[model samples]
Target chain A: MPIRGSDRTSNRRAGGSPQRRLGARKRNQESLSGDPESCSPSDPRQVFTRRYRASIRTGQEPPSQRCSKAIHQGFELEVQLYPLKSQLVLPGDSLTARFIDALSAARLSARNGDIIAVASKVVSLSEGNIVSLRKVRTTALARKLGRKFEMLPEFAQVVLNEADAVYGGVPGVLLTLKNGNAIANSGVDRKNALGDSVIPWPADSHRSAERIRRALNRKFRKRIGVVIVDSRVTPLRLGTTGLAIACSGFKPVRDSRGIKDLYGRKVQITLHSLADGIAGAAQLLMGETQETIPFVLVRGAPVQLGGSYSSNSMTLPVKDCLYMSQMPSPSIMERDHG
Target chain B: MPIRGSDRTSNRRAGGSPQRRLGARKRNQESLSGDPESCSPSDPRQVFTRRYRASIRTGQEPPSQRCSKAIHQGFELEVQLYPLKSQLVLPGDSLTARFIDALSAARLSARNGDIIAVASKVVSLSEGNIVSLRKVRTTALARKLGRKFEMLPEFAQVVLNEADAVYGGVPGVLLTLKNGNAIANSGVDRKNALGDSVIPWPADSHRSAERIRRALNRKFRKRIGVVIVDSRVTPLRLGTTGLAIACSGFKPVRDSRGIKDLYGRKVQITLHSLADGIAGAAQLLMGETQETIPFVLVRGAPVQLGGSYSSNSMTLPVKDCLYMSQMPSPSIMERDHG
Candidate 1:
C-alpha cells in the first residue's frame, strides 16, 4: 500500500481521519523528527514526512515528551495509500493480458509520460520464452555437460535456447544472451514456477516496451512511456532494483554538466540516471513471487514527458558497466554449470 | 548547466533568429506525451504534462561540420568555472568567511529551496574541530587502548574528540556524533590536510546548516536550503556520495506510499531519499581538496521549495541501513587500526 505523510491540519479538519486521533493521543510531534534536541530551531511551519514515525515512537516517548509534541504540531503533509491485490504471473502473453485486464478493471488509463513498470518475468512470458523440460531430447553432449555441472539434461537445452554464445571457464560455461544481458544461465528461471518449466529472460525488452507503449496508447488514446524493468544484481547491494531493460517515450539519462552550484561553481560529472531511479522506485512495488502486482503506473515523476524515444538510450553496453568487470569469470561459469 | 531536451520540429523551423537558433540547436522544447514511434497518431494536438521523458539528449555535441559553413554555436550553458584561488587555511572562521567571499565574488544568489553543498573539511575548520597530535597528552588509558588495538596514542585523542559515544565494536568504536550522525571515527579526517593536524567531524552539522542558511538569507533577503555535506564511505559503492550531515529548509524524505502503479497497485516501499540524491549530485561538483570549490548551489531541481526542514529525514537508522548489518565490522575495525 502507498504510504503518505500525515496532513496534520487537514486530517484534524476532516475530523474523522484516524491520523488526527493518533496525533491527539500523542499530543507530541517531537518524536516525529526522532531527536528532541535538534527540533528546537526548526520552523514551526515546516511539515515532517516519514513512514516509520509511528512505529519509531511507540513506547519510546522519553521524559521530555512535552517539547517534542510542540515540535510535531508545526509540520504537515498529505499522504495517500494505494494497495495492490493478487499474485502476478510473469513472462507470458497471458501475464501481459492479465496486467491489461487489471488496468481496465481499476479504470486506470495510461497517460502520456506515465512510466509503466512491467516485471521481467511477465515480459519473458509474453515473448513465448517459456520452456518445457519434459519435451527436451537430452543429447549425449547435454548429458555430458549436465553430469559435469550437476544439472538436469533438460536444463542444458533451456540455457542453450536463451544463450547467444558461451565461453568456457574453470567451472563450466559463461553464457551471453542476445540482448547482451549476461547471466550465469542465460537469464533462465527455475525458481518461482512449477517443476520442469523454465523461463528465459525477455527477448528485446526495449522492443517489448515499445510494443506495450503502442498498445497502451491505442487502448487509452493517450501517449505514455513504457519501462521494461528487470531486477538486477549490483556488485555491492544485496537484493535489487528494476533496471530499465528497455524504454520508450521518455529520456532515461539527465546530464547536469555546466550547471552552476549555489556557489556558482560549474558542475561536471553529474549525470543523473533517471531510469535507474524510476526503476528503483518501481521495484518497491513489483516484488518477486509476492503481491503479484506486475505493473506500476508512476505519476508526478520529475522527468519531462515526451520526445523521440528509444530504449537504446538507457541501455549501457556491458563494457560500460563497472560492476560487471569485478565478477570473476570462473564464478560466473560455476553458476552456469551448477 | 541544467541540460534539457530540444524539440525536433523546432530544429526544422525556417528563420534563424538568435532565439530561434538557440531553440533549434538546443532543442529546449517541453515534451508532450504520445507514442514515440508513430509518425502521426490520433489526438496529435493533445499535450500532457509529463514528469520523465525517454529521449531527452544532453551533453555537448561537437560543433557540427555544417555549423562551420553556417552559424557558430557558442556553449549552450552559461558556466562560470571557479578554481580555488589559494590554499585555504583551516581551523578558523577565516575559512567560512573565505567561502562567503567566494560566493559573493561569483555573484551567485540563493533562491528558496536552493541547497548549498559544502565540504566537510571547511565545516570542520569553522567549528575548530581540529586536533594537533603534538599537543595531545597521551594517558595510560590512551596507551592501553592504542596498544590493545595496535594504533598510535594520538590517534585515540583524535577519535575521542570526534566521537560522542562509542558503540561496541572490535578494535575501533562505532561513534555516534554530537549531531547524531553515526559513523566510524565520527567522520574525522587525517589525509590531505597539513601534517599532524587531524580534522574532527563538524560539531552540530544541522546547526551549521541553519547558521549558513540564515546568514545567506540575511545577506541576500532570500530563502535557501543549506546542506553541510560529507563524502561518506558506503558499504558497497567504491566511492562516496555527498551525504547531508546537516540540512535546512527542505523536505529531505519523500513519502511515496499510496502512490499508484500503472496497474493501479499501491506502492508500499517507495520512500525517495531526496537528500541522498541531492547530496550525490552535489558530490559530483564538490570534489576532494584538489577541486578547491567548497560550495555548490543547485538549481532547477524538481523538489518543492519550502520553509519545512528535517535532518532526520536524510538519515536511515542503523536498523534500516541494509549495508551496515551486512558489512564485516571486524574488517572495518582492522582497517581503522592499520
Candidate 2:
C-alpha cells in the first residue's frame, strides 16, 4: 500500500508547539485555497499534484519475511518496473512516441500536484543519446585505464565514443568526460537500448522534465508535475534505489529543525529526502526486468506548487560528501552489449 | 505530515483482490460474537497506524527547495521520531507501573482504532534486564576479546556480568554468551539509562506486549492494540528506525498480490509491513535522548485485532545475503564506558 499521511500520527508528540504551528499553516493554506493553481505568488502556500501513475506487471518474489517485518514497523518499500514494450524498437524516438501514445491510449492524465516518473532510458533514447563505438578513437590513457580495470575493448570504445573530452584517469577511476554528471565514462549506456549502440545520459534531465510537464499539461488541459528518474548507487548500500535526476512542480527536500517532538523537545538536524523516497516507491513499480510500468501516480501528498522552476536546487554538490564515490563505472553499459 | 491512505478513488488501485477478501473476513469477524476478553489475532486487514506525523512546524524551515519540488510533484514526506524518556529510572517494576498509570490517567475517550505505542526500554527495565557490570567475574577470553574490539573494562565487565557462559570468539566477532542475540558482548548496555549500571536486551518482548495489552484492556475496558517497540540497526541504512518487537490486538502484516493497478495490471510481491511502519512512527515519539515521550496514541488505522503472539515471526535471520552486513551498531547495552 502507498504510504499515507495518517500513518505519521506518532511523529506528532505531546508538546510539539512548533510542529503544531507548521501544521496549522499548512491546514490554513489548504483551507484558504481548494486548488493549488488558484494560490497567488508570495502566498507562502505551496501547491503540488500528481502527474502519472503506472503499474508495471512483474514476476518478482514478494518481500521476504524480514523485509515485511521491517515494513510492519514502518519503513516502506517501493519498486518500479520498466519492461521493453514490444511495439517499440530502440535506437529511435519511436519508443518514446509509443510510450507517450500508450499513456494517451490508457487515458492516463497528469494533474497539478502529480509527479510523473519516467525512466532515464526512455529519455536517453528519445534524445538520440546513442553512441557508435566503432567510429570512436581511443587514447593511450584509455587503453591503460581499460587494461587496469579489466574493461573490454568494446566498452572502452563506447566510453571514448561519448566523451566530449576525457579528464584525468587512474586505473579504476576514469574521470567523467562531461561537466554536468561526473559518472564514470560520462554516464554512457550500452545495455537495454538497441543492438551495437551505447546510450549517453540525457543532456538536461531538468529541462526534459519541464518540457514533458508542459506538453502533458497542454495535451490534457491540466497542470501537472514531472520527475525524470534514474537508478543511482547510494554510498555503502548494496542495491540501487531510484533518484530524481530532474523534477518540475515539486519540493525535493524537507528541513526539520527547531521543530518540537510530541513531548515538546526541539528537533535538530533532521532533513528528509522526500524525492528519493517517492522515487524509491516508483522504482518498486518499475522493476529491473520483465515489468513494463514506467509511470506512477502519487496522490494525497501535502505540498505547495508554484510557477517558478529551479533544477539547480536539486543538484547535490560534490562537497556535500553524502554520495558514494565508488559507484561501479558505466563499464556495465559497454560490457552488456556483447 | 503523516502518510495517509490513498483517496477513495485510488483505493481500487492500492488494494488487491486477496486484500479485499481479507477485508471481508475482518468485517465478518467484527460481526461475529467472539469472546471479547481474548486478544484478537492480527491479519492482513489491519491498516497499521503511524505514531508520528511529519509536518512542517512553525519555527522549522520548510522542506529544501529540491524536496519541496518533489512534494509539489505529489511525493509525500512522513517522519516519526522516537525520543527516550529520561525522568524514569531503570531496573525496577516501578517504571512500568508509572507508565501504565500514566497511560490509564490519559483519558480513555479515544475513538475506535487507536493504538498505543510503548517503548521497549521501559519494558526491558521493568523486566529486570538491567545489569551491574561491576559485579561480573571476567574470563581471560573476555579480556582478550575486549581488547580486540576496543571495549572498555567496565563494558567488558558488564558483558561478563550478564553471561551465563562465555563461548569462544572469532577475530572480530564475539560468539554469544547467552540467548542467541549474537550481539557484541551478548547485548550489554551502558548508555541512555541513568547511573553506572548497564542493561541487557529485553527478554520475550512478545510476552511483554501480550501482558501489557491484557492489563490495559482490563483497566480501560476498551479494545485497543499494543505494540512493543525497539530501535534496530537496518542492514543498509545509516541510522536506526523503530521495529515492532511485539504486538497484541492487531494484524501486523498485509499481503498485496493479485492486486490490480489503476491500469488493471496485476500487482505481485507487495506485502505491506504495517507493524514496522507503526513502530517507526512510534519511534518518533520515543527519542533516543532528551524528549521524554515514550508512548503515543494512534487513531484511525484500519486493522483487525487478533490472538496468538510470536516475536520470532518478526525477526529477520542474519542469513539473508541481500541484507546489508555493515550497519553501525546501537550504543545501547554495548558501548565503551571507560
Candidate 3:
C-alpha cells in the first residue's frame, strides 16, 4: 500500500519522543515538496532514479528489480546504509526484538520493504548456538584436528558438529563445508564470546532469518526482509566481505544465462546475486571486530519482497560448484567430476 | 584541512550553478546546524560520526584512518555513489579528463582525500588495452585451448599473450594469471568489447591507476585517491562483487592481528581489506552493465593517503597462496612452488 503523509507522521509520532524529536529530518523531507530542486543532480533520489532508468536497458540489474520502468515522481528512491550502534549482544538473548528496538532507538523506521541485515554471529549468539570448551566431549580425532589449526579439542569438536564435512586443515586455518558453504572453521568465532566459549552458526539459519522477518513484520504491521550475513574469503582474493548465509523476503538471484544484453546479444554467465551484494555493501560499515554494528538498514534497494524465500536459493551442492568441479580434490566433487 | 562554512559555501558556488542550484540540499544542511534534532539519529552525518568513533577502539579499522580520533564538529561523512551516464568510451580517450568532466557535470566536487573508484574496463579502454581478434596470430596451443572453451584460436591467442601462464581449461572458461592475479580469460570481456574482439587487463594497472590519480589531483588541486576496480567470482559462491585491482592513494588493508576485540580477546587472522571493501560497497551502485555510473565517490572511509604503494601490497606469490598452494596444478604454481 502507498504511504500517506498523515500515516507517515502518525507512524513517526507513535515511535515515541525519540522519533518525534527528529523534527529536522521530518521538516526537511516535507520542504522537498513543490521544490524544483528535487529534480536537480543535488537530490540523491533523483540521482538514483536517473541511474536506475539508464541501466535498465543495459541489463545491468537483476530482472527482479522493482523499479525497472519507474519514472519515480516524488519517490524517495535513496538507498541509505545506516549502521546501528548496539551493545554487546550475548548468547540466548531475543535477537529479533533486540534489533527492532535498536532500530527504533536509532529512529530508523521500518516500512513496507526495508531490509535488516544482521551478522550471522549475532544471530548465532541469540540462538544460544554456542558451545563451552569446558563442557565439550572431544574425540581423539578432534584433538588431532585441533592441533593442526592451533585450536583446542573442544573447539574442534564443536566445529565437527557444525560442519557438513571437514575438507582439510593447515597450521592456521581449517577448510570446512557448513550449510553447503565453504567456510573457515564453520564460521565459528570466539572474538567477542564470553569466558571460555565460541559461537558457531545457528543450525537452521534460513529458519532463523524467517523467524526474525516474521516477528518484525508482525510488530511493525509491514513487510520487512531479513538477511543473516557472514564474512568469507573470496577465491584468490585477499580479506573478507559479507556473504548471505540465509535470506528471506525476495528472490536472491538473477539468473541471466540466456538473457539479452543491451545490444540484444545473449549474455552468458551473469547471475546478479542480490543478497550477498547487499551484504558486501553493508559489511563496509559493519566492521568485523569492535564496530558493534551487526545490524545495517538497507533502504530503497529496489529488491522484491515476500517471506517465501529460502537458503536453498543461495546454495550450490559441492559436486556442482565450479570452484570444486575444477579443483583437484578428494571431497564430494571427486566422486562426480574428478 | 578544516572546511569552514564560508569555504563550503564558496566551493558550492564555484561548482558553477549546478552546485549552486542545490537550494534544497543547502537549506536542509543549514537547518541541521544548531538544531538539537540534528544531534538525533536522523542526521546522516551524525550517524556516520557516531558509528565511526564507536568502531575505532575495536581495532576494526586501519590504524592510519584519517578520522581515528576526530571530533567531527559538523561534516558530511557520506559515501555517495554516482553512476555516470556517458556514451560508449572508445580506446585512447583521455579517461582522466572524461571522468573529471562527467563528475563535474553531475555537480560532484572532489574534496581533499576523497577516493574515486574507476571500473578497470574503462581504464583499459582508455589505455587502448584491446586485442583485435583479426590481428592475432594463433599457435597450436592456442587452437587446442580455443576448441576446449569454444573460443576462436585468435581470441585464445590474446588470452595467451596476456596470461602469465595457463592453468588449464574447463569448457566455457580458462584459468589464467594476468598481472599476477588469477582471472578467467585474463580479464577479457566480450560483452562491451568492439565486434570480433575482447578487452583484457591493462598492461600495468598500478601505473594506470596512479596516472589517473595524478591527473585528477592536478586538475582539482586536492589529495584524491584513485582505485581501478573489477568484478570477480568467489569460490563456491555465486555472483561477483567489486575488487580493487589497483589503488593509487591509500594503504588498502587493515591488518587486525594481535588486536583486541570488544571483549578484549586477541583477534587473530582478521585482515580488513579496506580498498576492496570500499570497492564492494561502490559496486552495489555501479552495477555490472550499462549503468554508466562507473565512477563512485567513497567519502569518509578512514583510510590514510600516500602514493608509495603497488600491486605487490595486495598480492601473494603462488607458493604462499592458500588456495593455489592446495590446488592440483601443473602451471605457474608448480613451477613457482613445486
Q: Which digits, one per residue and each the tens of the lDDT, describe model 3 over residues B1-338?
A: 11122122112112112232254345444433323453555544444454543433232443322233221222223333444434456788888777766665544567655788888888888889887788887878778877877877887777777777677655666777767677777777766676766788778989988999999989988777888888776556676667788998777776677767777888865776678777776666664653455577765555667646787677667655545555666354323321
TM-score of each: 0.43, 0.44, 0.79
Which residue pairs come into collision in candidate 3? Answer: B83-B293, B84-B293
- For A1-338, candidate 3 gives per-residue lDDT tens digits of 11121122112112112333254344434333323443455544444444543333232452322343221122223355666656567777888767766565554567555678899889988888887889988877778877876778888777777776666655666677777787877788777878888888887999998888888878888667888888776656566778889988766765657655545666655866778777876776676676677788776555666537668777666555545555555332222211
Point out where model 1 deviates above 4 Å. A1-338, B1-89, B94-100, B104-108, B139-150, B164-182, B325-338
Q: Relative to the true structure, how large is the alpha-carbon lDDT of every model?
A: 0.47, 0.45, 0.64
lDDT (10s digit) by residue, model 2, range B68-112:
222222222222122222345446665445555444333223323
Q: What TM-score does candidate 2 get on C-alpha atoms?
A: 0.44
Best by lDDT: 3
Sorting all predicted structures by TM-score, with the top scorer first, yields 3, 2, 1
Give a tens-digit lDDT track for model 2, residues A200-309.
76777778777777777676665556677665432122233455666776665444456543334443224444454455445434534323445555432222343444
DockQ of each: 0.02, 0.05, 0.24
- Candidate closest to the true structure, highest DockQ: 3
